[model samples]
Structures are given as structure tokens and as C-alpha cells.
Target: MNSAEVLSSDLDLVRRSLLVQKSEILNKHMEFKNLQHSSAKATDEADAVVQDLQDNLNIQLHERDQFSLLLIDKALSKFADGTYGLCECCADVIDVRRLKARPLATLCIACMEDQEAPGKHLFQ
Candidate 1:
């Protein structure tokens, strides 16, 4: 497909991803707050563990929301400049499969592979 078509699709996906992230962040914030409030009332180790899990989830959700915001901003800027498919790392056309999977991606598969290789534990 053409660059214009790819950019259009990427923008649409970025918009959807931002919306979903907003909702998820809000929900996670609420859950974390509730857990914090009730944690003092926790009577057993199980409740403490659950509260700890909720705290961890809140941190993860916040990080993901931040990442989503950054990706959205980058994608919008790229769309405006008509260079969305050009890899930020190498200025080459990103593979279609990679772009389809990560619509807001600013780097090509090769660059992404290098970035990911050094951070395998960060993924999950």
C-alpha cells in the first residue's frame, strides 16, 4: 500500500489506542485508589497480597498510559509531516506487518528488533 494509505490507517489506530488507554487508565486509577483506601481494613495476608497486586497493576497501567500518549503524539506529528512510515531509527520504510501490529511505531522491524533484544524482560 501507499504511504498515505498507511498513514491514514496508522492514525486511525492511534486514535483508537489513545481512547482505550484513557479508559483503562481511569479504571485502573479508581481501582488503585479503592485498594489503597481499604488496605488499612485488610484483615489477612491474602488481602495484603491483593492490595499489593493492585498497586503493581496501577503502576503498570500508568506506564502504559504514558507510552500511549507518547506514541499518539509522535504518530500525529508524523502524519502532519507526511512521514509516518519512514522509520525514525533509519529513515526507511517500515514493514507492513510491523506497522500493522504497532500502528504508531516510528521505527522499522530491524531497528525494533535491536531495541527489543536488549529489553526482553521489559516486555512482560
Candidate 2:
């Protein structure tokens, strides 16, 4: 395929992925909000602990979704700058499979592994 076609295909993939994730996040948020409202009406002391745990889990999920949204936004911005699919750390083209799996990935696998290595920051 031509470069323009390839770019259009990749952009469509990333956009679709982001839209799906955002839809999921919004649905979860609404569910959690409903749960919170329902729980507020509960008077049973035994259920308090369970509710607390559920609330904590919901908060964690929301935080994770927010971070994912940020990554998606950054990826979209990179697309606008004609830099999408290029590793942020090494300027190498990230593998198409990896990009398909993680649409917002900024680093190639090797660079990601290096960043994730134990004591990597200590050496730097």
C-alpha cells in the first residue's frame, strides 16, 4: 500500500481504539456513579466494608482510565505531528503488531524494556 493509505489505515485503527476505550470508560463511570447513589441509601453496617472496597476499586479503575485517555490524546497529537508509530525514545518505527496491541505506545519494545529494567534509572 502507499504511504498515504498506510497512514489512513493506522489512523483509523488508533481512532477506533480510542473511541472504544472512551466509551467503556464513560459506561463504567456511569455505572459507578449509579452504584454510589444506590449505596448511599444503604443503612446496613455489615455492607459498609464491602461498599468501601467497591468504591476504592471504582476509583482505581477511573484513575487508570484517565491515564489511558491521556495516552490516547498524546498519541493523537503525535499523529497530527506526523510522528505516530515512531518510538519516542529511539526514533525507530514501532512494530505494527505492537501498535495494534497498544495504540498509545510511545516506545518500541526494546526501549520500553530498558525503561522497565530494574535500576535503569540508577545507571542513568
Candidate 3:
């Protein structure tokens, strides 16, 4: 088909991928919550230390999953507003390959590189 059709198809794919990721994250989060609630109390000092470390790791994982969900939601919102695949900084269309690789990416490669450059200032 034409360019518009191709872009639309790509966006649809990205949207589907994002939704799948969101669902997976939600399911994992639920499982984590259940596991946390059902965890047995430590009976010894060594067990307590191990449990504390495990709890810390679980919290970090939960936070990471939360952040991923937020990014996925933001990307889905962009799709709703007809702005998916557009760079947030330069307003240029982001490469479909990049989007396919990182569905939550909001910047084109050039803008991303610029932002990551040393001594670069980011406003807001």
C-alpha cells in the first residue's frame, strides 16, 4: 500500500505490542502482590536478613514494572491523540524500526542522541 497505509499499520503493531506489555506487567504485579501477602515470617536472624534482601529486591522490581506500565500508558495515549511515532523534542516522525524495538520511545534517534550528549542541557 501507500506510505500512510504503511505508517498506520506500523502504529497498529506498536499499539498492540504496548498493550500486550501492559497486560503482562499488570499480571506480574498482581502475582507479586499476592506473593508478598502470603510470604512467611522469618524465624531466625539469617532468615530475617535474607527476607529483608528479598523484600528490597521485590520492591525494586515492582517499581520498575510500575514505571514500565506508565510508559506504556503514555505511549497508548499518544496513539489515541494521533501523535504516536513522533519525536517529542523535534516533532519529527520516529523511525518505525525504533518504535518496533522500543515501543515506549518518545524521541527520534537524533534527538535522543542529542539529549544523551555530554554537557547537553535539558529544559523541563
**lDDT tens per residue, model 2, 4-48:** 798679767876887788788778878888888977965687788
Per-residue C-alpha lDDT of model 3 across residues 14-112, encoded as one tens digit per residue? 899899999999999898888778777667999889888999999999999989989999999999999988999999999999999989999999999
Residue pairs clashing in model 1 are none
Cα-based lDDT at residue 6, candidate 2: 86
Q: Using TM-score as the measure, what is the rank order of every candidate, best first? A: 3, 2, 1
Could you arrange the candidates by lDDT from highest to lowest?
3, 2, 1
- Name the lDDT value of residue 123 in candidate 1: 75
TM-scores for all candidates: the values are 0.53, 0.79, 0.89
For all candidates, the clash counts are 0, 0, 0
Give the Cα RMSD of candidate 3. 2.7
Question: What is each predicted model's overall lDDT from 0 to 1?
Answer: 0.73, 0.83, 0.90
* Cα-lDDT of candidate 3: 0.90
* Candidate 2's TM-score: 0.79
- Model 1 alpha-carbon drift over 4 Å, by segment: 1-7, 43-83, 113-124
